[model samples]
Target: MTLSSENCSEFQYQVLQRSQTLDANCLLFLIILGKMLLNILTLKMRRKNIYQNFMECFCISLAFIDLLLLVNISVIFYSRDFVLLGMRFTKYHICLLTQIISCTYGFLHYPVFFITCIDYYLNFSKTIKLPCKWQKSFYFSTVILIWIFVLAYVLGDPAIYQSLKTQGTSPSQCSVYVSVQGYWFSFSMVIILFMAFVASWPDIYTLVQAIRITSYKNETILYFPFPSHSIYNINSKKALLPRFVICFLGTWSPFVLLQVIILLFKVQIPAYIELNIPWLFFVNSFLIATVYWCNCQKLTLQSIVLPRDPFVNWKCCFIPFTINNFEQIEKPISIIVC
Candidate 1:
């Protein structure tokens, strides 16, 4: 027996709604997984360094911000006719708050990577010598200022407009709309992508230079003359700048490029891409978290092997080691240089 037209329409609607709900739940699951991984890595780093190093502090702060953003997105996903923690928020309010928080946290990621790169270059290159206390204070102040500026910018005009639109509307009638084709919006996307590219360049350059310098010789050796009385081996702290830079760029560049194309050309994004963008963000979060976790592992191993063999001590600090044949070595003599 054929179904009535009204019944067919109702069935289609139910199927669509169910599909959307399933998609949202899957995205939320991915976000939760990413947050859990990041939290574990951040906690480990905090315990290891206690915010003593600028990189450790930056990683912890970034992880926290990312978790907050992910939670906000998850709230927005399931806020439809739902009560959260005994308080009922209109879907409009939830969506607006989510947008504001996401934008603030997303844009803030740029500066974190930028400043981390700068710090890496300065510390490793031994350029622009400054007191340790002064450097720490400067970095801490900069992080605070960046968050303040991002929050202010995100909550200013754009958020206010969305908030005003939702006013006087019933909770069930509330919805979110972003004008991707607007001139100002496109311009803003361009500006953001440009800034990210510029910010990433210095780190990329530093990585390339380091690799090139190490590649020319068969075995690149690093000698750190620590104080005789010092128990901890500070010599093996090789900067993982290259890995961090690669991870960030690899994960984010695709999303940024997609935004640029869509905004600048007034092109509609494909349904597949629209569905996968959130997952991309999750992948990015996971990769960055793994980078921090790996670095923490390296630090832990280095701490364990504090007083290494003096013969291999100079070579252990070297990154990107190469194996040498006897022909390259010229002789079987052990050359010890103090």
Candidate 2:
């Protein structure tokens, strides 16, 4: 396991760093393993309906990437004498590969965001509905393009090359890597969400005062008990905005705090951990919230097409959104529909 070094200083550093490096490696390995298992189970359960949503399409590609990353890391760990062609495998190559893959994965958030934005905009604002087959193809194409573009850009960029090279020649701090783009992306999301939280504070307070829930579960959260009349009519625009805020705050406040600490102390999050199921689900919630906020006047459960979330039940934002209001909503829609 001895690596050739240019000086006594470098050699001594690697020796002392070995334990720390192994610890980081073990953590990284465990994380990827968990993600792989969760992803496989989710895909198995949702296989039939995966093509129905934009996030689900992204999950297909992410699951493949997760599988590849896990397999590569596993092979590098289990077989010390593993060799390919004429070259012997070593720790350095594996670390470099991990860094590169991570950096590439980090940059993909942008493309995914952009494409999803366009998809939502077209779907909500436009009258024509795209056929299911066409929608599938659209997501498939974007996922493929996202992989190709991110790989090409990251591999071609000199910054990533220099970063990995620098780490190779020294006692690298982390076995898994977080790219600049990934760090800032996480940072930016935290800030955006914080701003949203602040903006909705008054509304959230009002909503809390307006409704009384029996329990914390999704179905029970929105339920109003018999004969008890709360201040909220549940039909008011005041209730609409607050329900979204409460839902967003409830589901994501912890992640937002985690990101804040990450940004404050500068935690390096590996790709597999950073771009995960919970993170994606949060992003899905955020996107849906944004769309709902922007087009508040166009929300009717039956007329509008808000994707049914498996995790956060967003329809609670419109708890009383029944056929009774259908006639009224048809004339002039409000903020919390569909």
Candidate 3:
């Protein structure tokens, strides 16, 4: 069939859109699967520790939320052109689901963050060690508190109500769009809280003292504590502080600041702003996995299976299998008839 210019443009747009949606779904699926497998493998390898178990469970929950968000986005995109098809599905239902999930995951940030900080504090403080059962109870209570706070705040905020009113773009398409004003307030609060938490480090005595003497700040990197030093390693206070800052600021710095600026300046943020939110999520996920892998010896052992204690250097054991595979492939090639 011959295609007119209008038809060709429309067809190409649909194909491009579908291709992008499929890519996102595949990437999200792989990430979720990788996380789940890693968690299972880790659990099998090591006796469960309280912090580790909480992290694994929390990650699983986050993964589920991510999966839900992706599925909703996919459905919306798939039905974009056909209002009747979209109407049959109802965007409002999906949008509500997304909002709930979004709020759930957003609130989870505080507790997870607080727990990480507390974990570091407890390790450094040399306080009385609790039994695993007690620790589990404490962790659950913290999570409950987090959710309660989220619900309470959401209920009080008039923004959600306003956003609900504007739910669907067309009869076919629904979205819970946060008012620009509400978005700014919520975004600012998170940034302020994050900064406060980071600033609560009293033991940053050295860094603070160093800051006083460092003039011009151009040589600041040289003056700051480097990770390689023994002083930095054993002290959970020192080690975790940097990790927390890197994670808290690095992953979120872009989107948070962007929102704040957009709100303060009363400028319309470019379409790219919405796109960055998901990109930030991906960055945060990768950063957390990397941090856990690099710092937590207990976590690394669980990512793979082995006969003996895998902590005894897993890389050394894989060489023999790799060599055998290479030899087998070499022999097959040598014996092949041209």
Tens digits of lDDT, candidate 3, 92-174: 34444445544444444445545544554453333746787886676666655665776677556788645544553232233
Model 3 regions more than 4 Å off: 1-54, 67-89, 107-111, 168-338
- In candidate 3, position 184 carries an lDDT of 44
Question: Using alpha carbons, what is the TM-score of model 3?
Answer: 0.37
lDDT string for model 2 (68-165, tens) is 88888778766745679987876555577677777777787777777777777777676558788987887788788888988888778898778876
TM-score of each: 0.40, 0.75, 0.37
Which ten residues in a row are the worst by lDDT in model 2? Answer: 329-338
Candidate number of the best lDDT = 2
Candidate 2 residue 221 Cα shift, in angstroms, is: 5.6
The full ranking of all candidates by lDDT, starting with the best, is 2, 1, 3
Arranged by TM-score, best first: 2, 1, 3
Clashing pairs in 2: 299-337
Of 1 and 3, the candidate ahead on lDDT is 1
TM-score-better candidate, 1 vs 3: 1
